[model samples]
Target: PLAEKHGVTIETSGDVAVSVGSHALLLQMTMNLVHNAIVHNLPERGAVWVTTGVRSRVVVLAVENTGQKLPPQMAATLVEPFQRGTGRTHTDQAGVGLGLAIVKSIAEAHDGTLTLTPRDGGGLRVAVQLPAAPPDTGR
Candidate 1:
């Protein structure tokens, strides 16, 4: 829905291995990041890229979009609950800023870590890293 709203096409690649917990949480996290990218980006056609891969012992997932640059302070506080950026002018988007916070919590609960980096082309890339599932040993 958000991708269509901003005329932003989404491209996804790679795979993930989950040992436990509902896949819904991961889907929600991806949805939140994509929605934020669509809502915060400059109102021009853009693209959102979602990629997943295995990095050493961790599974890495990244969502990146094109948009206006974010202030360092605002970017730092993006994962905080109810935190909003100073440049935010959109009022129609219903968000209390708790989406990232929820994502963070869910990641932590799964023994994973979340990171956000400002992309070079005036956008943001959010990543979630989770430990790979342990090898099964027949008991």
Candidate 2:
């Protein structure tokens, strides 16, 4: 998998029940996060962790990776279109830098939120929280 190519370990845990959202948009959001986690990671000791679960009334999905420390301010701007982070500007793997931007946009359309935070030691963690769907009451 992509994790192997980057010498990163993939850890996944937890389970999230189905929620309401556009399948295509959710898949796109997930792909972007996973791709970024692999493409932008520490040359050594790279690791990616994926998790999903229900918290309170929300469905949560998180993608985290071992990477170089990202400037907090720059991390905030990463969700904006065409904005690239440090060292990303010169990479052939770099796209137009709209990955996170699109993820954030799609998240909002589904009544969800996207957050980016720098992890202790090193690396970044992104969490997407979406409102859980109401239980169906068959008539």
Candidate 3:
């Protein structure tokens, strides 16, 4: 919804089947990630790409978006508190800047890891990797 309003499109793909200690917390973390993508995207022709997969026994949820180029140093700070990038300032929605920080905390609490990287062309890629749930033995 917000993507459409911002003239940005969203594309989702891949296997998202994964387990987490808390579904509610995972949802919250996902929301923040998605929100950051949309709110920081270009004015138009912008896109948010979300993909999930299992790699090396870890479940990966990655969210990427089209935006400005961020320096490696600046990009590293995005997960810190109150570290909002030079995101789309003209947009109607602005955040209090705790988005990525909260995400980092949630990922760590689940024994997972969060990674933020600057895309080669432009934009940012955010990934959360969590341990896959153990197979249910019905014990």
Candidate 4:
């Protein structure tokens, strides 16, 4: 597993029972989260926690990692197309900053929502929530 190769532990919990969108989009969104977790972490070695479950009428998928805390202003801009934060001093992890924006776009296309929160202690947490699939009528 790439997580193991990178020394990033994964903690997954709960069942994600909804199938509300294209599999491609789901994979893309998840990969984006994983990539961001690995790339943007503090590089001091940390774990990535992925949790999925139904909360109320929404299906929630969360990705969390330990890393340098992002500035509140920059966190607000994270979903803007091609907008890289001026606070990032790491040149090696360079990115156009479109990843989260793309994720947001895909989520919106699926009638879902994306959010980012500052993790307590340290790091960042990214969450995506989608409407639950309609009940199967077996028609």
Task: Return the top candidate by TM-score.
Answer: 3
Local distance difference test, candidate 3 = 0.88
Q: Model 1 over residues 75-95: C-alpha lDDT tens digits?
A: 788888877553343466567
Model 1 regions lying over 4 Å from their true place: 16-19, 86-90, 136-139
Q: For residues 5-124, what per-residue lDDT tens digits would candidate 2 score against the true structure?
A: 778887889895567989998999999999888877888768899999987789999999888788788789888887776644565665778899999998899999999998876788
RMSDs, each prediction?
Answer: 2.4, 1.7, 2.3, 2.2
Q: After superposition, how far is residue 55 of candidate 2 from its true place, in Å?
A: 1.5
Q: How do the predictions measure up, each by TM-score?
A: 0.84, 0.90, 0.92, 0.86
Clash list (residue pairs), candidate 2: none
Q: Which ten residues in a row have the lowest lDDT in candidate 1?
A: 84-93
Question: How many residue pairs clash in all the candidates, one count each?
Answer: 0, 0, 0, 0
Q: What clash pairs does model 4 have? A: none
The candidate that achieves the highest lDDT relative to the unseen native structure: 3
Model 3 TM: 0.92
51-118: candidate 4 lDDT, tens digit per residue: 88887778988899987777676677878876654444345555767788989998899899999887
